[model samples]
Target: MVASSTSSRSIAVLNTAPTQPSAVETFIGNLLELVIHSIEGVRGRLVGGSPQR
Candidate 1:
């Protein structure tokens, strides 16, 4: 019974560990996107005219 309980706990931990990283990755990805967008906006304002073909 002790072994069974320990295995189940380990399994639960393994399942939760992967999800935490996924959430962290998702948060980082969103933060990066926001930074990129803000930089682009600033660049557009500084440049004034649009790019030529």
Candidate 2:
């Protein structure tokens, strides 16, 4: 027999910055950081020849 699991995801933007420019900058910085980290993690896994979870 085979079993599987399911999960849900979400992305909420909760910012109350008075300035639009600052809020956008903050969001962009966070997004970029997230992408960079994710890429690094994937690269590490590939280099180690480990199957991605």
Candidate 3:
């Protein structure tokens, strides 16, 4: 299916796309990322490998 710019509904959907990730969602995502990064860093150190932070 194709979205036609002539339709107001399609335009609204496009606008909402950027706001889909709200503040709380973004925060949780960032927190999860940091946790994953820390885990990887520790694993790297244990394996005698360097992790580029």
Best by TM-score: 1
List the candidates' TM-scores in order.
0.58, 0.56, 0.57
Model 1, span 1-53: residue lDDT tens: 47998778757767879667567668889999888887777777789855332
lDDT, candidate 2, equals 0.61
**What do the candidate models score in CA lDDT, each in turn?**
0.74, 0.61, 0.78
- Write the residue-wise lDDT of candidate 3 on 1-53 in tens digits: 55565466646655879665466467889999999999999999999989868
Q: What is the C-alpha RMSD of each candidate to the true structure, in Å?
A: 11.6, 11.3, 7.7
Model 2 is weakest, by summed lDDT over 10 consecutive residues, at: 5-14
Q: What residue pairs are clashing in model 3? A: none
Per lDDT, the best of the predicted structures is: 3
- Model 2: per-residue lDDT, tens digit, 1-53? 23332111111222433456567678989999888878888997879965344
- Kindly report which residue pairs in candidate 2 clash with one another: none
* Model 2 quality (TM-score): 0.56
